[model samples]
Every structure is written in C-alpha cells, then in structure tokens.
Target: MTTFRESLARVASRRSFLAVSGLIATAMCRPALAQDAGTPSASGWAMTDGRGNTISLPTRPERVVAFSPVAAALWELGVRPVGVFGPFRQEDGSPDPQIGEVDLDAVVSIGDWEEFDLERLIALDPDLLVGLSLPDVPNTLWYVPEDASATVEAIVPTFGVTPSDRGHLGLIEDIESLAAALAADLDAPGIVATRNEFTAAEAELRDLLAEAEGLTALVISASPDEIYVANPSWFGDLRFFLAAGLPIIEPETEERWEILSWEQAAKYQADLILVDNRGGGVPFPVLDPIGTWQSLPAVQAGQVGPWHAVAPYGRRAFSNIVRELTEIIRQTDASVVA
Candidate 1:
C-alpha cells in the first residue's frame, strides 16, 4: 500500500470528488432516517479471514464493527452492522474522524487506529467484533505487543483483508461474507445492476486502450517517497489495465508498493502515469510536485495525471469509480495519435 511521508490532506474541492452509489441509498441522499432493526443471520462459524483468523459466531450478530473498508462489502452483501471503519473526512484535521457517513445511527462508532476507543467498543456490547487478519499497512494496523498478530486473534475474531484470488474477492468480497453474516443477499438487483454498469465501463476502457497505441505508463504519487502504482492485482482504477488489454510496468518487489525516483520513473518507456489516490500507493497530493517537473519529459508532455481513489470493491461507489477512471483514460489517451 502507499505511504504518505507528509501528513495526508483531503482536497476540499469538487475537482476530486467521485461517487457511484448502487441505489441502495435512495433513502440516504437526504439526511438521517430511522431504519428498522435489521434481521440477523443463522447460527454458526461462518468463514476465515486472509490471515486465517477464524470466527465462531453463536448467532447472526446484531451489533458489528468493521475495522477495514473491505468490510463495507459485507454490508452490501446483506451483512449490515452497527459500526464501520470507513473512508471519511476529518473535521479537525485529525488522521481519522470520530465518525463519518458510514454510521447508520443505529450503529455505535468503533473507530480505526487513530480513534480506536477500546473502552467505548466494549461498552457498545458488540456480539461480534471483526478485524483484518493481515497488516496490509494503512488498511488495518493495530498494535499487538509481542506476538501482536496472535494477540489480536485471541482478543477479537479478526479476519484478513479482502481475498485476492477469489473472482468476487478483492474489496468486493467483503459484501459476500457480510451478506452471509447478515443473512441478506445484496447481489440481487441493486448490487448486480451496479456490477453490470462497471463491467460495461471496464469494457470501454479496454477498447480505448487496446485500439489506441499502447501508452507506456508509469505509476506514482504527488511525492517522491510514494510510488506504489497499481495493476490488476490492486483493484480500483487499475482494473482497467487488465480489462482494457493495457500492459503494466511491473518491477521486482514483494511489497504492496515500491518507492521510485524521477530518474528511475523517467526511464519508464510509458506514455502515461496514473497516481494511486488510495493509501495503497503514493499519497494523492504528492503527485502535483512529481507531475509538474520540467526536466521530466512525461510532465512536459502532460502525460501525467492523478487517478482519484475509489474502493474498486466498494458497494456504494464501485460503479462510479469505473466511470471516472474510464473518462481519465479516454481523455488522457486522446493526446496520443492512433
């Protein structure tokens, strides 16, 4: 995942806003509305997380707190919870906010690292507490003293980040697993419709990339320290590389992201550079400095631009991200003569 050397800041302007709700929130475009108590799922030990964390839940849990964004996929899959660790805008410039839009009023706030109030979490009386099994960096990282990983397993029934090999996995896997927990199938009409839209958008991106001269592209952030770019493995806009038949610039590395310098970045025979706005690659703002350098030929040619971060697996905005990424690819690729 991308790491920001400097403190991360959210851009306030609409120039960097993109969302595609799956119509699940026709009720949410407004303000708060009371929702009836959600029905619970059956009794049993459901599944295991990425790190092999197993949860033996007695009954469908009514109170739930997700420590990872991928867990949002659970809500879409019919696993509604009382709390969520979501992507939110902090009011006081704190690394994380106390609570954001993810909470449905009925849900109590069980925050992430910056705002993890273990006391409040215990008071909330959660029947099931789920956590990310892996230390996928910013996605989910909690301190476990010695053998912290094992300690976490002992404390709460933590699960791993979204699975990678599963076709329905990635960020989206959260929805399916969550559905099983909530006893609600979210993929029927609303989720399925959004998925179809994304499929079409991805197809368009592939057609545009394949038909046009393959632009040798480099991935970077606004800053030098951050340069982990995405391919098919990392979801979000990067999916286009695979769906569009575009070739990726793969470097030898086992980590989620790698830091690359301008000279090294310049060496890439790519026609474009797509910045990872998510924490997985380079922090978003750092892309500005890296993109405007006159010494670099790609910047001079205006082949550098930022890809807005979106949960490729998010149930609320997955389709929206696809549309935005497609537009970027189309507009950016327009400069290249076929």
Candidate 2:
C-alpha cells in the first residue's frame, strides 16, 4: 500500500552482491568441512517417495533431475538437472512453456506435480526425484502420495524436502541436501556462505531494525489485494531482509498473511510496504493498486518498495534476483546511506 516515492524515503533508514551467483553463491574458499562429511548418510535427507517406495540413486549422481519448482534449488546448487516440473500448456502434450524463465528446456517435464508422466520421468532416467504435495491442494494425489508403497521396487532414490504441508521446508532443505548429495565442491560450502551473507547484512542493520523500532508494513498489491508477507513459506528468498530482524506490522491475531484489503492496510498502520508488479498483471491478478494504495500510511511515511518479478524464497527463485534486491535495499537502508 505504500507508494514507491514514499518507500524511497525510508530506504536510507534501512541498510542493504555478487557473481550473478544463484542464492547458493558458492564462494571459492577453504573447504567448509562437509556438514555431512564422515556422516554415515545424509541425516536430514530421505531417499524414498511418498508412497513408501525408495527412489534409487547412483552414489555419485551426475545426470540429476527434478520434477517441481521446489526441486530447482538443486540446479542453483550446481546440480545440472536433466528433467524438471513445469507448465506444459497442454493437457496431453509435452511440458513445454510458451515462456520460459529457469531454462525448463534443460530437460523433460514429468508433467505438473499431478498428472505426472511417469513414463516421461522414467525416460529421463534421473537418479533422484524430489516430490512433495501440499495436503490440502487438490493435486495431493500426485505427490509421491504413496511413497514407495506401490512401486517401491522401481522407485529411484528421492528426497522429501519436508512434511507434505510445509512446502517451504520442501524448497529450502531440498537445495541444501541436493548440494550435499552431489558433493559439489563448486557450491559445497554455499550454505555457509549464504548464512554468512545474511548474518553480516543483519548485523549492519541492527540499529535501523532495532526491535523497538515498531515498524509496520502492508505489502499488498496496489492493483489488487495480493499479499506478499514475509512468512517462512514463500518469502524464504528474502530471508536476508527478514533475518535482519526488520520489524513487521500485522494483526496481532494473525501469524501469517497472504493479502490485506485497503481498509486492512489503513488499519494496521504498517511502517513499510512491498508491491508486486506483474508486467501489468500477467503474473499477478492485480496489475497496480496506486489508485487505491497511494494514500496508505506506509506510503505517506515513505517505506514501500517494488516487489521483484520472481518468487523471493529459496536459492532457486532468488539465485538471479538477489543482485537486484541488493541494490534496492542498499539504497534504502538508512544505515547504508549514513
């Protein structure tokens, strides 16, 4: 609900990278001493599907593959996927995108999480497949729903990122394990590098984001009521901003948020805001809400910023966008300007 100009005013109040590196941003440094090193096996990772079937894997898997957006984290961590899950635009056709962002062309499609082309997946001959389905989602049927229960024999070694309901963990842990599984030296230590990046950035902004700051935010679309709250779920890509201990303003009763109405925006009195731009609405149902949001308090207070075009969580989504965010936040953080 905040105006761009207004948000600019508070950026100097905040504080805000690199190889064009993906979120993994693996820096060439002394080996981090593998977190999973000398471990009997990956502790946090699983090699079975939801059906109780075990997904087989080669010890040193090189031709890796995945079947969901969540699995893309493997790619960001240096796993060149041979297959992935993406919109095929066809009910019965190949999973091809009229528009591609993350190189869906890298491999074949297993068909969206549901309607998975088992034959297609087998055709790719991937050693591992990351599968998860939100319990409430209709497509829950397709998620490794049974695990290796049905075809435990034919299943490849796969990793379940998290509990079915927790899509966020599925995305984050998948990347972490994918890197560890590959023994990828190029990005093997990336997890530490990323956490370090977040820690350094957060320390610098401690003053600006002082817990007592009590800054409120209403990150709704100016065009519609699409919410972009910094929940652990979707916004994990923006972990740096959230981990910075930046104050959040939301209703006391609510622990998470998806969208807030204009009245809700005015009521919460958020000190900051984020707006999603859908290239005029292709990505978000709402195009721009400047007409309705121009007058919100956060906008009046000048603490709003334009949300990026991609998902702001997980290494897969943030790999390419952190660079842009770095510039935006650096310009806004009051600490940086001072």
Report the number of the highest-lDDT candidate: 1
Stretches of candidate 2 off by over 4 Å are: 1-62, 67-71, 87-103, 113-115, 133-157, 163-174, 186-214, 221-240, 258-263, 276-291, 300-303, 306-338
Score candidate 1 by lDDT. 0.45
RMSD of 2: 10.7
- Candidate 1 residue 151 Cα shift, in angstroms, is 6.9
Model 2's number of clashes is 40
Candidate 2 C-alpha lDDT tens digits along 261-284:
555544555555665432222222
**How well does candidate 2 match the true structure in TM-score terms?**
0.57
CA lDDT of each prediction against the hidden true structure: 0.45, 0.41
Give per-residue lDDT, candidate 2, residue 38.
19
Clash number for model 1?
22
